[model samples]
Target: MSTTTLPDVRVARDEQIAGALALALAASLAVQNAVVIWVGAPSYADPMTEVLAFHADHRSAVAIAVGLEALNLPLLLGLLVCMVGLVERRGGAGAAWSRLAVAAGAVLSAVFALYAVLWIGVVLAADGLTEPTPLLELVWQMHAGAFALVMPALGTTFVAVALATHAGGLTAPWQRWLGLAGGGLLVVAGTACLPIADGSSLLFVGMPGYAAWLVWLIATGVRLVRSAS
Candidate 1:
């Protein structure tokens, strides 16, 4: 009896940790967006001069946003690993989907890391520069392109995980549909990544989808914690 109870306790603890990580990641992403908005970060379509000025004026805010992203990366990985564990333990039909989710999520995390690094490079290049040099513009462009490319990875992870969770009986039908729809939008945006990197308005297509994902994360985290309790 003691041995059985010990394993149960451990499982519960793991679930709680996973839930917490999900919530933390959502919060971190929300905060990073807030920082970007607060600092009035320029769009890729904005003139190079405007982009340089924004970076120059809001170095501290950009730094904070980057720091949050750094925190978010590990939280994302932790949550993904935990979700995979849950799916494998209870997933019957979902095993394949979970594997796909983990693979896509790993790519998403890697791309996001690259995005963050590119932003860091942009900031460094903009430092002490009165005008936007060609090199600075180039780095900034690379950053924008990296961000645009992240959409596909994010969409794949979102869709795969939603299907896996649903197959494992961890999510409702509505939740699964929501993930599919939202993830689809992101993928659509990814299809036009080249234009988006040039500052195309199509980037907005992924915003709502990403918001849906955040809502899903919050709801899923709550459910996981409740179940553990």
Candidate 2:
């Protein structure tokens, strides 16, 4: 009956939207990682002069980093919206998970955006300022601290997404586990910030956890694409 088939049509439509968004999100994540690495960014503890010098010399790289990070914000929001829609449409407690995911994603996006903005400021002032070392150093520390501190928000997002996917059968069990495990690592990275001063070493968890998260995103995107087809 036409009535009976209506639900199927709607479900298919949701899958198509979710799939497209997921794929875009995956690409954005990959581009961000590539740009960051290509820029040869300095560490959190690196001297302010060293940091400014790097950006000043490699202005183009700085621009690329800023652009890619900013670009990821919208892509991330879109991805979360699509995923939440899919979960809500499936009808259940998954809605709760979806809400949590959105909240966490929003926080993560904001933090990343702030970090990107600081980098933008750094680039803009790199050539102009003679006594910018103190200011630059302060911004550097803030940016690094923000980056490390935001891991928990991202971890929460991952966990909520994993729950939603499990409930909606959106991804495989192993993939869900991968997400959970990655999230746990992020939590560890956040906790590693306890001493604050020694926080740079804690970044080890962030680097590996982020890589894992990216892998999970790629896998999820593949599934979404397959479903759409």
Candidate 3:
């Protein structure tokens, strides 16, 4: 008698499906964040307006920042999902370093991303409880922007590592490009938000890159959905 074990096709299929899901989530979050910028930035587009606004009530100013920063949660989640999907592929592939790299970075960065969101919540709740001051204003905005910086930094690293580990050709080229371009644009766009008072205008600068990545993600999701059948 002879016996053989069947390969774990279920796990393999799930991993592929997850990669596509993560891509779609990231793209949707990016677009949603851009929408908020479009809705809110016009009110404080002028540098002088921003300065004046910040003086009014650190609460309100931080309010705007908080709302915008909210987007980071989903973006980071998507990044983690994408990283996991990519890392999962290496489970028994002998690329221990690559798998570990993405996982460790995902955990480290997700912490900051979550902290960034919670900080805004703290500031928001503190609005009536504490007095608003320039120092506090700077504290929130500076930190908000700071977290934004680190997020994309680590996010991009994850993308690079994932792309390095991913084994596919032009047929699935969008996934790799989305990972690279999405993460890159996020870093650039987040940095650009620092220079301009109106994150909206600056966000448009990233629209092309964002759109490219977004479409890539949606397409990936569609592919996965179809594959499931």
Candidate 4:
């Protein structure tokens, strides 16, 4: 009996940790988006000069967003580790999906890291430049492309984790469906990543998907926390 109870306690603890990490990740991303919106960030269709000016004028805000992203990557990885462990321990059927989630989450983290670094470079380079140089445009484009590519990686993680957890009976049918829909949209948007990087309107397709993901994160986090309680 003691042995059985010990394992239960550990599972509960892991769930709590995962829930907290999920909430934190969502909050961090929300704050970053708020900062970007508050700064009136230029759209992709905007001139490169306007983009350069925005970065130069709002260096501090951009830096803060980058800092939050740095924090978010580790939180994401932690949540993935916890979720994968929980799924594997609870249901063997989900093992394959959990593995896929891990792979995709790893890619997502690496891509996000690159995105943050590129933003940092942009901020640093914008320090005193009055106009956008060819080099600046190149770095900015790379940064944009990196961000666009992140959508597909994120989509894969979302779908895999949702399916894995559902197989483990850790998520409801609604949650599973939501994840699938959102993930699918993101994947579709990723197919046009080059255009998205160029500031095409196709990028809008992923915006709702990303918002759905945030909602899913918060809802799932709540469910996990309540289950632990």
Candidate 5:
């Protein structure tokens, strides 16, 4: 007896479409998410802190940002799985186990998103709902878990995956590098929180990286969108 297998063109196309959209969404979301982090991690000692800082004072924005973080996992994972699904259906094409990269990013992004909610909640709910005291609350917030540390790990990992898969694809090498670096910053910024969460110290060291990473991803997404169109 002989077994026959056929390619599901419809499924393949759907996966491609999903992958593209997810990439675009991830890019857009990264920028928005970073803005929220900056806003959420605002310090009281500085004037900018009292102004853009919302975690201690603005529950609504905190909640909104937190909610966005929560969605990171599903969106990332869905994109990754679909991306992988496309790879498999096409052939043993790209890098080995590229899906693992997606998995790393999806899992890590999810974890970070979840903890973002927890951390923000802790900051908002602090008993000493004032300027200086509430500032310390942010410090206590870092130890919540190594979630911050892992997010960057995932971000960088996803960057690698994107590069590997695009080894010869239409994506420009420069764009790929930009994404890889952005993802790296996400992880680095999160990890640096390990030592200091006291007053926005993480912002100085990590925000630039995180911000760059987001911008890079957003740029890549724009390229992808433009290409598709």
Candidate 6:
């Protein structure tokens, strides 16, 4: 293509990337919420029977949640790529923090996505076996462990994002502060998870903090898309 068209093509690609990232972020949030809210997935402390029953009763929802989470993996990667692209375009010292955020986010994405797959197995296999309690407990423990382990990564990603945005003044002051606070809470939740294998009540901090972060993600995505426009 001619030089004139090259820039236009580049702009279109950038917009598409930004839009996809935004949609992905929104989708990830929506899927998780639907699983918990609509499917009535039990709390971490619930007995194995309850967990099994919940999954059995809501097998379809569980399956869909798993699929959505699997889909989220690519979306997460796309968001990270678009974020890096946006940061690099800004041409600031904060690019380092953005890069770190992207790295941590990638890890966070994998951890969550893997856990979702495990849960899918739990849901599918829960009803078939004659004695599934032990298996359910084991899987639940593994899920809890994965959740705990990934918390630090999510925290780091948020904190790095906060730093990058703060340095670049790319977001509102409150939004940056939300990231900092959410990151700290996630780290604390991880630490709390160590002694409390049943899933610390504090680990529930992830729920609200993550919810708030979802809003931030939505806002960020919108900003990115608008800028591309």
Best by lDDT: 4
RMSD of each: 1.7, 2.5, 6.4, 1.6, 5.7, 3.1
Instruction: For model 5, state the Cα shift of residue 88 in Å.
Output: 3.2
Model 4: clashing residue pairs?
none
Question: Taking the tens digit of each residue's C-alpha lDDT, what string does model 2 give over 56-162?
Answer: 78888777767777777887788788888888777764778878999999999888887778777777766766555766666666667677767877888888888
- Could you tell me how far off, in angstroms, the CA of residue 2 lies in candidate 1 after the best superposition? 9.3
The CA lDDT of each predicted structure is 0.87, 0.76, 0.50, 0.89, 0.56, 0.73
Write down the TM-score of every candidate: 0.95, 0.89, 0.55, 0.96, 0.67, 0.86
Candidate 1: list runs displaced more than 4 Å.
Answer: 1-4
Residue range 15-73, candidate 5, lDDT tens digits: 45654655655654765566666655544234423533454566666666667665666
State the displacement of the C-alpha of residue 40, model 3, in Å, after optimal TM-score superposition: 1.5
Candidates 1 and 4: which is better by TM-score? 4
Poorly placed runs, candidate 2 (over 4 Å): 1-4, 129-132, 194-199
Give the least accurate 10-residue stretch of model 5, judged by summed lDDT. Answer: 44-53
In model 6, the worst 10-residue window by lDDT is 193-202
lDDT of 6 at 204: 81
How does model 1 score by TM-score?
A: 0.95
Q: How does candidate 2 score on lDDT?
A: 0.76
How do the residues 11-111 of candidate 6 rate in per-residue lDDT, one tens digit apiece?
Answer: 55675686657667686768777767876788777777777778777887877777777777777777666666655656675889988988998889988
Model 4, span 66-138: residue lDDT tens: 8998899899999988988999889576889988998999999999999899988877777789888888887
At residue 134, give the lDDT of candidate 5: 46
Q: Give candidate 2's TM-score.
A: 0.89
Give the Cα error of residue 121 in candidate 2, in Å.
2.2
Best by TM-score: 4
